[model samples]
Target chain A: MTATAFAFAPGDIVRVKDDWPERRGPAHIRTPYYVRGVQGQIVRHLGDFPNPEDLAFGRPAEPRPLYHVRFKKGVIWAEDRADDALLVEIFGHWLEKP
Target chain B: MNILDTPSDRLLAAVRDLLAQKGIATTAEIQERIAITDRASPGQGARMVAKAWVDPAYRARLLDDGAKAAEELGIPMRGMPPLGVLENTPDTHNLVVCTLCSCYPRGVLGYPPFWYKSAAFRARAVRDPRGMLAEEWKTVIPDDIRLTVVDSTADYRWMVLPMRPDGTDGWSEEQLAAIVREGDMIGVTVPTIG
Candidate 1:
């Protein structure tokens, strides 16, 4: 498939879809389990690229928008690390409006 | 020497044999790739850091597009993942980790350090980055300073543009580059002037 417009812009708060095991079936997923269902702000849209999940299987892949999402450490860990943050590169399909 | 003593050694040999048997890639080609990878080291990244410290234009370009900036310095970044550089400041510090695997800027930093690939590092980098840095590298990130841990878990690879150490003023770019160690670029340690 051809490249399309980005879904999320920088500063947009989005949530990761927690469907890796049930729907994705674990085929070279880049979204870490820890960030599943976590909300983060989009730092930047890193343009569209072929989905590595599909490319790993030698299948025809379509370009997907990728964004650098920043999550607070407190959101992912039990510790109250409000000053710490994690920047994750997540594809558009794995993200949704929170 | 036992070539296949370890699982990784055995796997490498088996894959090489299969590739050669199928004429997919020759053994010499594989060795050439290894040579290319080995030639890449933290020194390449240190040069970029040093140049950015002195040249504002270069620094802006480096922040805009790390791969292109690396190419400006004659580093061949073609065919490698897009390089993302996280700039460090007095108020904020940056660290790079691949929670999934050891995803790193191999084109610029050669290879990820052994500790960087450890399970403990991956698990704690995002959990307790400030604590981990103080414990392992003895580099403390003050509570007032924000710590940002980047997970290079996808298409783009990441490296830290560490803040230039104080008291290095009036130093040449090459001289400044000498003090920028591998750990500094990895964000495990900071570059110090001695």
Candidate 2:
């Protein structure tokens, strides 16, 4: 089956899908735990590429749009001391409008 | 010390031998791939940045399409991951990290540093980027400027285009390239004129 496609522009706020429980099994996962379920803004569209989550299991990779999402210091760390942003590349399927 | 004697190394050796025995891939082909990775260095990335500094049109193209722009400069980018060039301006700074793995622009910047692959860096880079930069890299971002940390997690790898250092007007591209270190391109530090 083909991969589900979604359009996301820069500056759109998105929350990463919290799939920690489902993804606990043995598989190469790329999403970091800190940013899961956190809200961030889309920095850029990194183009469509094969999903690594599926590719890790020796399955045919379904192409998905990867994005660079920027999270503010306050959103990520509870005690915000730095005035900078953190950006992470998240697949389209793992992001939702927040 | 022979570092390639571990269990993982043995597994890789077995896999390579199996592939060769099955005629799927030759040992020579495997060595060629290893050579490609070893030959790539930060100098390649510095040259691209120097060229961009001297040429505005080239800079535009480099930001627009990093892989194509690199190929135009005779940098072999075929069979490599897509490259994204992040430009650092006066009001903004860019930092790169691979939280999941050491995903880097190996074709342009060679191998990543040892610290880059560490779990500490992966966790702290996104958690406390400014603190990590200050304490680990000795890079202090001014309070006014916005710092953006990029995670190279997927198929697209990234590199930073640092701002041209002052007091280097009319300097040759080669001279500019001389001061552009790997740390500068990774946004761990900025380039300086001597």
Candidate 3:
């Protein structure tokens, strides 16, 4: 969807260019258990990742890009995966430019 | 100065004031419900697994989204955001640890279990996982299976989905749940009680 579609919500897809080499967790606010340090592209933008206005107890403001990062289950849970393919879609901020 | 007037004491006073205003039954009720337990404490996640093993829809939702899945079971996740649950099938086993800090799903799972927040467990788990398991929790793993320890932190929360134990074709939901302990949910122990 167009960024305009998001009004001031900060919408639009951007590719992950890189990740902090020494960070503890992923870059996103709400990261997944197995998605740390994983690389992927943003397929779509879901408004601002956490618009300030939508915050539980914070000032009203658009958060950040919350993209959908797709990963093969094989890459993540492959250590003991039963199936050859396991597909998962996680949020955008979860990824860094990589 | 009034106890309620101090700045540092304001938050606690406010809580007391609110409780008094509502005529809340007692501090015990509040304590029992709001107390923080270790995330990996002995039987924390065991409770959730017990709940899910008996409830089909709950199990499906847990497999889908652990945060909402937890809410459906009446677990409150106020401070803990972005919860994710992982399932362990016969072929795969999942373990959780926070190498950086003790970040856990306290809202749904309760306080971080003692072993979770311990420095020894933290340092040794990352260095020698197999040894830590055998020595600390007394968990023994076979040589064939692969083991991966997940790290929970500021941005993410994790839970393990344990494989269903065999042999009980017609066990009641409660019966099955009774057997799924917290250790199983953490990947240190398999579900054998039920």
- Model 1 chain A: lowest-lDDT 10 consecutive positions: A1-10
**Please, what is the TM-score per model?**
0.89, 0.89, 0.58
Those runs of model 3 whose alpha carbons end farther than 4 Å from true positions after fitting are: A1-98, B1-11, B14-47, B54-57
Measured with C-alpha atoms, the lDDT of residue A79 in candidate 3 is: 49
Candidate maximizing lDDT: 1
Candidate 1 wrong stretches, greater than 4 Å: A1-6, A22-26, B1-32
lDDT of each: 0.89, 0.86, 0.57
Q: What does the interface RMSD come to for each candidate?
A: 1.0, 1.5, 7.6
Candidate 3 docking class: incorrect
Chain B: TM-scores of all predictions: 0.86, 0.89, 0.72
Error of 3 at B51 (Å): 4.6
RMSD of 1: 3.4
List, residue by residue over A1-98, the lDDT tens digit for candidate 2. Answer: 34445668899988998778444677676777888899888888888888787797889887888888888867778786556777788888889987
DockQ-sorted candidate list, best first: 1, 2, 3
Please provide, for model 3 over A1-98, each residue's C-alpha lDDT reduced to its tens digit, 9 standing for 90 to 100.
Answer: 43234232223233333344337642323343445665433433333444322363465544454443434334554443322222223334444443
Worst 10-residue lDDT window for candidate 1 chain B reads: B1-10
Evaluated at residue B164, the lDDT of candidate 2 is 98
